[model samples]
Target: MNKAWEGDQHNLKPLVQLLHFGYHQAMSCIFPVAIFGTLALSSVIQIPFLYRYDAILLILLAVQYLMYRSGLETRDEIKVICIFHVIGLVLEMYKVWMGSWSYPEPGYTKLFGVPLYSGFMYASVASFMCQIWRRLRMDMTGWPGFVSSVLLGGAIYINFFTHHFIPDFRWWLTALVFIVFRKTWIIYRVRITTYRMPLTLAFIIVGFFIWTAENIATFFNGWKYPDQHDSWQLVSFSKISSWFLLVIISVIIVAQLKYVKANRR
Candidate 1:
């Protein structure tokens, strides 16, 4: 009894809180720099130039932080992360096939025996360490979150339209299929969970602005394909709005994560 009480008393101190916080900050900073830095050093980094993708990834981490402010609990983050990325992989592959973009996936690696050209990005995506996302309450019944993520992905398509860089419809269609099926995810057996306002809005606004600005700059700088029409106007509402919707979806993801983590503890 005395030992247990003593341990509780020790954990309740203000200094313990500060020490815990300091430890977390140190860990977060070291992680991104190390992960991205290591990838940068790899000889087989056959993907597009690193700057833009890293910038976007960094912005996403920042957005997650701003929304949670504290952090997330370990939940079902992997399924969510994989679903989104697989959607992206499909889109990217279709883009490559149509000559919408180009990269190296040299001869002999079979996609049903074809020399697929999208190995770099599809492979590079696995490096994100997104297992953290799986720690959330997934909604399998409702159309809201699923519908929203699909729209967010679609909005991604629209963002490039100003430049006339339309991806093949197959990309959009695969995302739609995934969105519809998110309703049947295993987590749906439980209640649909989410976080409250202000924080939700914070994640949306901060994440969106940071991601949009950086990606826009990256697009113009050649790390990504911009609108085929060469329409690079900052005032364009279509480009701006697409990111806004994406932000909405991002907030939903964070909210579900928050609920799952809090409950697990």
Candidate 2:
């Protein structure tokens, strides 16, 4: 029996490799899955003693700590996530003030109508990109230089706020992204094979999925547009463009750490 088991071990190699590949991809989703699961749970359960918003914030913080202690998240990744949290919080404060959206529920953890936990959503997005990049050993070819990318990202971030007051330059910014990243290729590995995609296309695809998730979140009372105060509606398709631009900002932030690591190596 032992001899037979040893003989069959070679036959199991492919299956083992496949499982290993899947595990890495699944690990990349841990942060996002935690966020979405909490969102789902919060929607249905209302505790008598605790606000759902504050509870979820605690839950997410616990999850984040566990990820770090378990080594599921690296220190550099946490640094990036923290920056993303602050960025998201700043945007939330401004957007709420602008009446772009509102959190209808009351919670002690909220300031200026934005729950502290809301920042985790943006951090989760950054976590996803960071984890996937590390797991797949991704690399970008034909990337615009750091200075150019940073300036472009700053413009996109600024435009998000300024558009409400001034003429929207989003279309021009979208064009700029194309011109900068048109030749860029995202190289990633799945199992033993490496595959590549256009960076621009990836932005659009990820943006579409985020827009879908936004609709689900709004339906579950995560936040509401002014129109949705009466009744829920699908998030506008136009928001996908905004998300697409946001993804660019995230990628640039993650890439800073990645490039630094590469240079060190």
Candidate 3:
């Protein structure tokens, strides 16, 4: 009887830990959830005298303000989000011009056929990373030197643009990412226990989830691919590789910012 009780307790312990990990992950995703909720609600509901895209833009602005004022995100984190917003908007303008994907809705906030609120979608990814880093007490081991990390990140960002004109170097960049981060590990805490995950594995995991969210976003008309214009369907699994590279860029920027802040203190 005692042996059975001990076995049950052992099983329950890991289950509890898993639940805790999941709960924290959800909390870290608050910004993303809000953005997704806005996408969904705006799709179904009408705001008089306002376009859907414009309304979404207003709602996201309010949400950002509330998150800052309520202390849900720190000032530094807000800066990070804004930086990513610009980075994302620039990419959006280029991609839309290149006919990669598009905003099908009309909005006053449209610039070069891309909606302003669209940048928030990218910023939300950065928000998640920042929130999770703090909530999980994340750190890195075997981090690469500054120049190598920065050059890799720059290459990844540039490749997003250059791929249209030149040969797509994404596979090459992916290989470099693995080689550069081969020894890097993400150390994070779940409850009282610390866990380690390879940095590359973490990027792939987050990228897959981002790709999943992309499907949901497209279904709600957040944006549409050429294929999705006729009927909604799943985003290509190949895009996961694109997002995998993007996740690396996001992490590198955030990690460097965190390192800078840590050293300043």
Q: Which candidate achieves the best lDDT against the true structure?
A: 3
lDDT of each: 0.40, 0.91, 0.96
Which candidate leads in TM-score?
3
Q: Tell me model 1's lDDT, rounded to 2 decimals.
A: 0.40
What lDDT score goes with residue 160 in model 3?
98
lDDT of 1 at 114: 22
Per residue, candidate 1 scores C-alpha lDDT tens digits across 95-150 of: 55555543332323324222222222222222122221232222333435545655
Clashes of each: 14, 0, 0
lDDT of 2 by residue, 161-260 (tens): 9999999999999999999988889998876778799999999988997888888788888889999999999899999999999999999888877898
Against the hidden reference, what TM-scores do the models get? 0.36, 0.90, 0.96
Ten residues in sequence with the least summed lDDT for candidate 3: 22-31
Q: What does the lDDT come to for candidate 3?
A: 0.96
Expressed as tens digits, the lDDT of each residue in 43-134 for candidate 3 is 99999999999999999999999999999999999999999999999999999999999998899999999999999989999999999999
Residue 131, model 2, lDDT? 94
Q: Which ranking of candidates, highest lDDT first?
A: 3, 2, 1
Q: Which 10 consecutive positions of candidate 2 have the poorest summed lDDT?
A: 13-22
